[model samples]
Target: MLSASEASIEAELKTKGLNAPRLTPADIDAAIVGEDFHVFPGTTMTVCALKLRNGFVVIGESAAASPENFDASIGRRIARDNARNRIWELEGYRLRSLLAANA
Candidate 1:
């Protein structure tokens, strides 16, 4: 479902004059400063760096949420994703350690 939504959005972006760049995982990792992962009940939240065309980068949240009672978990994931994005922009290496430690 999430992949479908992502594809839908990507298609929409192309329609809106945005092109999808072919980015490798290594390129994405090189552009990323940090990430945050959270799990709650039946949901999983992951925030990571996404490299776009023309050297642009954005933070992306990949979530797997339960069909029922999704609001809370979804909202939490959004908030966390936003916060992590900000923190990554500021404290570049803090999240790197956390990510590596987890790995």
Candidate 2:
């Protein structure tokens, strides 16, 4: 891991035009489960990311549903899955492994 400082991460994100909102751990927890979102009648799972002071990004997402609602549920799953998949991809894992594990 690069282990860069939070300030550096913030700077880098800013340079990339990502407006990372400053949030406390509790805030992060709340955001994870869709607290930061408006209630959608057909809402399923919500997912988001948190940038830590240690330069590591913590991913927060809702879990799978029992009787899935394809649109929202799949959206949530894709959001969470994409974050994790990108990490493994960035670490040099082959796309085949990524797809296999996701299956």
| Cα shift from native, residue 24, model 2 (Å) | 31
Highest-TM-score candidate? 2
Residue 77 shift from truth in candidate 1, angstroms: 0.4
**Candidate lDDT (C-alpha), each:** 0.50, 0.46
* Model 1 segments more than 4 A misplaced: 1-70, 93-103
lDDT per residue (tens digit) for residues 1-103 in model 1? 1346556765777689765334322343355554444444555554545343344545556554554544545655675455445434543455556667878
**Which candidate has the highest lDDT of all?**
1
At residue 32, candidate 2 shows an lDDT of: 33
lDDT of 2 at 40: 33
Q: What is the lDDT of candidate 1?
A: 0.50
Q: How does model 2 fare in lDDT? A: 0.46
